[model samples]
Target chain A: MEESPTIYEQIRTSGYSRRDFLKFCAWVTAFMGIEASGIGNVVRAMETKHRLPVVWFHFQECTCCSESFLRSSHPIVAEIILDKLSLAYTETLQAAAGYQAEEVLYNTMKKYKGEYLMLVEGSVPTDNDGVYCCIAGKTSLDIVKEAAEGAKAIISWGSCASNGCIQAANPNPTGATPIHKIIKNKPIINVPGCPPIGEVMAGVIVYLLTFDRIPELDGMGRPKAFYSRRIHDTCYRRPNYDAGLFVESFDDESARKGYCLYKMGCKGPVTYNACAVTKWNNGVSYPIKSGHPCIGCSEENFWDNGPFYQHLASFPGFGIETTADDIGLAVGAVTVAGIAAHAVRANIKKRKLINADIEESKKEGGE
Target chain B: MEDQKIKRVYVWEIPVRIYHWLNALVVVTLAVTGYLIGNPLAIQSSAEAYLGYWFGTVRFIHFVAAFIFFFNFLFRIYWGFAGNKYADWKNFIPYTKKYIRECYDVLKLDILHIKVKPFISVGHNALAGLTYFLTFLAFLFQSITGFGMYSAMSDSFFPKLFAWVVPFLGGDFAVRQWHHLMMWFFIIFAVVHVYIVFYHDYVERRGVLSSMAGGWKFIEKDKPT
Candidate 1:
């Protein structure tokens, strides 16, 4: 192994200082929800470890994932994640073009075979020999397969790469397919979202660096730590949900009260992601916090779930019992009806007894 | 015994009664607020016309009521074991064969419009008892899922305890939809309850409405068991 260089030395040589390096590490630790004690491990890894060789590929996508990553507020994210990491080849970010870019990709594949990480953005189109999406006269499907053959691990960025997003929504023209659906042999981690929260992206990378392996994932291949809870679970407006307060319209009194947007077609209850707690724009606020209902963008096939603003009456939960919309309506209506019926039933019995007593009193008086 | 003598028998303990009424109140509030929120039928204007928050007030009241409802839930559970015999598990469950017979008789009479008068229990009748039992079960369901959703934040004890519901219910999306729909059941239940109470009071000429308030329901001597 090559001798490891200290991060401060690396950053200083790259024109940064010890304080700046430590601050960046602390920020990373906070973002990742790691303990203060874990800071040492993070620092050590960054200082001694050589940047992992990464090959980023773009397929049938709008390049939003790249845009979201670059928009990350943490300067170190750009400085270290982009600058320090050995990003060997990326079609969007790379300056070299034509044969030069192709040469760099080939050289990296040969030099770090079965060692480099493969990052895929967007979906792979498989229609007509994958003619819909191509790079340098080669189909995206062909390129992905060739590059994936020697990758150590694959990370599917955003819903496009993770679940095909809108490209695979309905009547898919390009036959857009998620990475795992096409290539299942290699270990894959899906970071799903509509341009997933920036911190989440950063956190995933940090976890990989610190643990030297992929984080535990749910059955869908999403990291369990970040994707386990629904956005409804962590929403700031959740109290309104439990209380049964809801916004009737975008301009109603309840909406002003910051009631749960659930009734207004907020998909938070069903969607899982870290947007509510971790938030966006640097932990400042999320869509729900800003009074917008969750579109459930983090979930797979969110594009086809339904219209964004129509409320769903009921759905099955964990099969504990169906809390159907009609059930609530039934209970509400039945409780009142049942109570009144019982009251009437009781009265009829009571009146019969009172009338009988009156007759007995009259008889005794006559006797 | 002296004529016109009155004796008081405890029908509901303090917490039990408190929980009962407050739960009723919140469920009603939730149904109303939930209805407005879900359909937004009450709103006639555009989203931007009213400061961008359409049903904000209803939702606020709904949440406040829900808080009260959950609080009542905690008390109800405690009272089930700690309450009087009339308010305990024995009263809440429909286990006896006699109770089953009463329910059958009542149903038959309703369908046939039979005129036979019968003796009635001071407590909730068989049918009423069963409905209450189911409502209790519904309350339990609501509370579990309610906290399950709440547990998402605070990472509180309840969400972890009830985490199993997530998978069993399919996913969070389904769980949430069920939660919203259940509100409608409560709404329909409330409407029917009111209609039946007033209808009986008018036709039977008995102080049935006062029984809950005064806790004494007098019966005529001719009534047969």
Candidate 2:
């Protein structure tokens, strides 16, 4: 391995000041929700640790994961994160071609065996000799296995690499499979989303660089810090839900006012993610904030769950089965009873009026 | 059977009655509208295909009624502690020895059809009181969990307060399953409650249903508490 220049030297060479470096650490500390005291640790790690070696692989995906990753707003996220990270081999970003790229991957695998990070960006195909996808006449499964064999840990970039995405959706002809399903020995972190927020991707990488290990993950193998709360939990229009103010139509006044989208086929109630809180574009707006419903891209198999436009029946209401329809059925039955009561009361009133008329006629006849 | 009118005092106030009826109305509305949204029962009218006005109107009514029912829950909880002897917490909870014995007597009278006279009180009967008490507990749980689920979207204060439930129920998927199952329980409870109320009022000639509307029921002169 080459004796690389220290991060400070690289930062100076890269045109970033010492003050800028400290500010970046502070920003990352806050974003990770760590205390100010922890800022020193992150700064120390970044300054001391050698640049992390990375090998990124792509298969059976739309490349949206890489698209989102490049959009990270943090200055170092683009500079120190992607640039100084010693990204030796990546099919999407690497410029080297043919034998040169393959040579770099093989050298990195041999040089930093069981030490470098392996980031897989897409799902692997398994059927028919894995012939559905190939690079340099080799199947994607073989390529992933060969690269993953020398990696310390792996990060599945998105839903495609984590849970097979739409490729594994209905009849999965190519036998598409997530990275975790194929590799069990390595510690795999699944950052699931159609395309996860750019900052979250940066945060995960930062956490790994700072902590030198994978962050705590939920049962689904997603980092707990980001996926802890549902998008619904952090949504701004929640008051409208409690108030029963819902947007009935896309063009309705309620929709314009940004009322709750629960009635309008929003899966936000059942979907869990940090979209509403962390948001996109520097925390400016999320799907719900942008007048779109959450399709629950973070959760597993969101595509197979159902149509995105149709509302779920009973969302976890009050942690109970208080679905909008269940509540409606209960009300409909009561309304019918109310109507019956109204009919009975009206009949009795009519009968009394007729009796009074008969009595008046009898009195007039007698007179 | 003719029963003589007695001095049976009104235990439920106008607010209490309003709360009760309003809750009933809203709960029913929520169940029906909620069902249609989930399963989407087959449409009967051709206009429903192009317009969907009826479904939309039902949903609007359902949400409005839910707001009222939620308030009703709040009011009832308050009344359970603040109201008169009958509406008070002591009446609902059968802790006293005499009330426990009365429960047995009431059950015996019901089973044997002994033609025994009715007792007068502002509160519910022992069995009825127990069921209502359970319903209140269910309502409280539902409110907290519902709010937990609700705040999940808006990041409201309620979800923050009850955020611990997310883990206890095993993530969003389990929470969703629990929420779905509990709705059916409420629907079943509502169905059985209506059936028994109507059966007593029409078949058994007990006039129980009328008491909800008129605030009183006639009892035989021979009855005593």
lDDT of 2 by residue, A137-181 (tens): 899999988888889999999889988888987678999999998
lDDT of each: 0.72, 0.72
lDDT of 1 at A65: 84
Error of 2 at B182 (Å): 6.6
In order of listing, the candidates' clash counts read 57, 39
DockQ of 2: 0.10
For all candidates, state DockQ relative to the true structure.
0.20, 0.10
Cα error, candidate 2, residue A22 (Å)? 1.6
lDDT of 2 by residue, B46-91 (tens): 1212233454566566546655777788888898787766677766
Q: Judged by DockQ cut-offs, is candidate 2 incorrect, acceptable, medium or high?
A: incorrect
**CAPRI grade, predicted model 1:** incorrect
